[model samples]
Target: MDQLTQIIAVLGVFLYWLILGAVATRIVIKRRSIGVSFSWLLIIYFLPFVGVFAYMLFGELHLGKARSSRSKAMYEPYGKWFSTLYSHNSHQPDKQSDYAASISKLCDSQLNIPSLTSNELELQHTPEQILHAIINDINHAKTTINMEFYIWHPGGLADEVAKALISAANRGVKVNLLLDAAGSRQFFKSEWPKAMKKSDINVVQALIVSPIRMFFRRMDLRLHRKIVVIDNHIGYTGSMNLVDPKYFKQGDGVGEWIDMMVRITGPVVPVINTVSAWDWEVETNERLLPAFPDKAQCTDTSSLVQAIPSGPGMPEEVIHQVLLQSLYQAQKKIVITTPYFVPSEQLLDALVTASLRGVEVNIIIPRRNDSTMVKWASSSFFSELLAANVNIYQFNDGLLHTKSVLIDDEHCLIGTVNMDMRSLWLNFELTLAVDDIKFATKLKGLLQTYMDNSDRLSHDEWQKRPMYRRVIEQVFYLFSPLL
Candidate 1:
């Protein structure tokens, strides 16, 4: 019996090795990023069972075959609509600098988002200001109010937003609200959606999840964009979610989150609205394209703005390529503010190479992150970033929830995209490329404010971190592609 047990154990080990070999072959055949493929290999190499489950759960970027088919069906129409929307604005000359023109051209060609000119933009900061502005727009919404957000915590000012939406719906305004199933799980459990529905507002959830359905979809693929279009004229998008800082995540020891939102008014509003419409149509199979601004309406503009939307079915590396271009294009200074900072090798290399070539690269992240894995993984990249003179500062006041990249004094990249892999590669994100000098100046000053309250990391000091912490960071770094 003892001999039989030993032989069975050896067979079990051999079977495990065989399974791993099969998984490795599949991963390499998939041809994911080198880091991602290797990370999965490491995860499987160590915790054989957990790694296999994790890879099964997250290894692929399949949002689902259903979504893929729907996307392919709509791809042609969506691209044509976007092109027509921009063509109407051709009367307005492309008054962008060479730098902005190149970046905008990349967005047009790669992301299929054409740039519009002459749009008015107001950069709103703080929860109080953003909520008030959005609520005011909701209150005044005459025809329609469309909103989508990742998280919508039910309390404080967010309740007020709910109230505003309710009131708007009661007043016969066609209101539509879209929330992510995972991020806004708490909101779904709350009474806000119910109350809004009572007022006849169309409240739909994106990327719905369940125990059984998890096998069919990548449950982690999130709709991370915050977008609102009021009356198909006023548009808002930024890092601010539907959560009020005062009531959300208070006990986490990371103070209230600091965020920013932009109030946009011009032809670009339609672009933003159309993006929301595409999302609504995709999730519900109900087309809201007609509700978007017409080609004639797209003619009026005040500033150069290009709306770039990226996600699972979209170009995987559109935003990543744009950021690389921005970094490479930066001749003077580059300031970036984001909550998460687990960047890919190309992103890290871009920053390092930019700094080496005499461009000042400043990155401001929160001192205390909400995710332990993100914190350690972010720190692990610091060794290379710091050595290359890329200045990294941890914001001390609160989680710097604003995701922004200000290049020189002429171009600005803002919206829901983060400096993390999930955002770059998986999540549905919306980004606005502004070729306006005024907006860039405002964003620059705002980032400077963040830097003022941040603590800079020194290369020597960072290298001197305790061995255990460094070890933890490296361990986390190995799984950054998973983060």
Candidate 2:
């Protein structure tokens, strides 16, 4: 070889070992769970060049330094204000049931979110109903309307809602709209955003992800929350996105999507507003005030809500811990409904343990999932769950998009959180820990409807599945940490 070729060969050999050493060190020291680390190491060894870059782009939980400093600075004042407001309106923990009180306490202790008691909550069951209610609220909105959603299509009933938003903006209502860059990518590209901006509405596309941005932060970390607040008095949240099911994901061939949303009017609305402000600040670098002061405090024994926001900023898996605790505390029944069910081993064990303890455990998942990987990964765990006598149902009607967990008939957690590791550990999720028998009863009725359209999995039948199919499921489950 020539002089230059010899030098290049030596440098390449040295750099290869250096890169391998550095990656191995980072992966080991980070201790990002054994499964995640193993997956990365496997890819690194097998893919070599592809794996090093992949790990660098999507490995760590880091979210860049500038965003970190901004989040830190923003949390201090928000924490103080939340403490002061929560002290006055929070429901006494002693009054709630053991599990309900524990979950509420966990939310307050971790995120300083208080359990609000004076709220009027209405559950919107259908997509059209949710859109109509939001549009009606926008028409009546006098001061401000804030909306944050993971998905917002610019067609169908969603477009009618957009018209309402534009009309509200035209009427001098301050409309602040924030949509996720990934989920609402098409919405941002559509003329609807341009029209809204032209109408002087504050429109923000949150977490504008890019391949170049991956070097600084985990590119897959998503702002998966769905929130809406009108005049700081009325708020809406749940699994429902701002898209009409008719116009959303139609090609998936999973039938029409089904979802649930809750409309709130009372003390809890401000808390939802506060989190929305935090998200806006994170994306726009513009500071906004906490939830506006509302005097509509109804200290009643009816509707109680504690908003729990979980994501990368948090030190622990707040929702995951809450789920485990709730599972352990179940006295009579447990119900969970989600479109995706790929979960960590701990969650699987918890469900199995609950069933082994004779707690009536019913898990509802979609039969015809939009993603085949999600379907197989979710199915891989059914053998263990079924063996433990945990009842599993596949909702054949459509994609059951409601993410909710009901414990007995007293506590219910409803929001955009899925049972998968993505929602449990990565995505910015919003879940309402509701402690009301009335709401739980209503949710139970809704869940029964889902079960009515579902087929129960038989343990014997599941064991008789084709060997190749079972192997495919195991293959998908191997990457559960990533999924």
- lDDT winner: 1
Instruction: Please give the lDDT score at residue 229 for candidate 2.
Output: 95
lDDT per residue (tens digit) for residues 197-242 in model 2: 8889999987778877877888888889999999988899999999
Give the root-mean-square deviation of each candidate in angstroms: 2.2, 1.8
RMSD (CA, angstroms), candidate 1:
2.2
Q: Which parts of model 1 have CA positions greater than 4 angstroms off? A: 1-16, 90-93, 291-301
lDDT of each residue in 1-483, candidate 1, tens digit only? 999999999999999888888988999998878998888899888987888777778888877877788888888888888777655643243577787787777877886777777578899998999999999999999999999999999899999999999999999999999999999999999988788888999999999989887898887989999999999889999999998999999999999999999998877888888888888877888878744354433323355777889997787789988888888899989999889999988899899999999999999999999998899999899999998999999899988899999988779899999999999988999988888776787888888889999999998888788999989988999999878
Candidate 2 residue 389 Cα shift, in angstroms, is 1.0
lDDT of each prediction vs. the true structure? 0.87, 0.86
Cα lDDT of candidate 1 equals 0.87
